[model samples]
Target: MQLNYSIEGGDFTNAGNASSQVKKILKKLNVDPKITRRVVVALYEAEVNVAAHAYRGEIIVDINTERIRVVLKDEGPGIESIENAMTEGFSTASAEVRQMGFGAGMGLPNINKNADELNIKSDVGVGTELEIITKLK
Candidate 1:
């Protein structure tokens, strides 16, 4: 199955919408609870990252019998350094974002921990893209 979702930056009210929908679909498909949890965790982290940092974003999800792949792309001030961004407790979120309690700097770390395979690319002035993959079988 394939699914797509759009995200508006600074829209915390709906930051988890895509992840929530995917969780429901995984449950209905009888996916293993543990795997589902991992996927959801990774997805939620990515989703929130876009909402907190990007100008706008898109999430594309593909699910098959063997695995699931999620691609998150956004238009915003991209990361200056993926290495720094991946570090725990490292973030460049605006003060306003921090005030909302959404930028604890754990997003990438959590996603990395939960995804079986992860890839990230960014252009400092362009945006960022993240691909998270997890095995289903």
Candidate 2:
């Protein structure tokens, strides 16, 4: 199965909708509870990242018998340093975003922890794309 979601920048109120929907689908599919939890957490973090940093983006989710994959693509200011961006406490979110209780810099790390495979590619002046895969076990 495949699912796609558009994420609007700065839309904190709807940040978790995509993740919520994915969670519901996984439940209906009878996916393992632990796997569902991990998938939902990773999806939520990726969705929030787009809302907090990107101008706009879309998340594409694909589910197969053995694994679930999520791709987040954004047309926003790309990461200057992938190394730094992957760090737990590194973030470029604005003060206004921080005020909304996000941008605490935990998004990427949390995603990494929940995903069996995570990849991020970015160009400083271009954009960013993230691919995450979690195995069904």
Best by lDDT: 1
Query: What's each prediction's TM-score?
Result: 0.97, 0.96
Residues 33-119, model 2: lDDT tens digits: 999999999999999998898888899999998999999999888889888878998988889989888999898999999999999
Give the lDDT of residue 116 in candidate 1. Answer: 97
Give the runs in model 1 whose Cα sits over 4 Å from its true position.
Answer: none
| Local error of candidate 2 at residue 86 (angstroms) | 1.1
Q: Tell me how far the alpha carbon of residue 131 in candidate 1 is from the true structure, in angstroms, after superposition.
A: 0.1
Error of 1 at 133 (Å): 0.3
What is candidate 1's CA lDDT for residue 130? 96
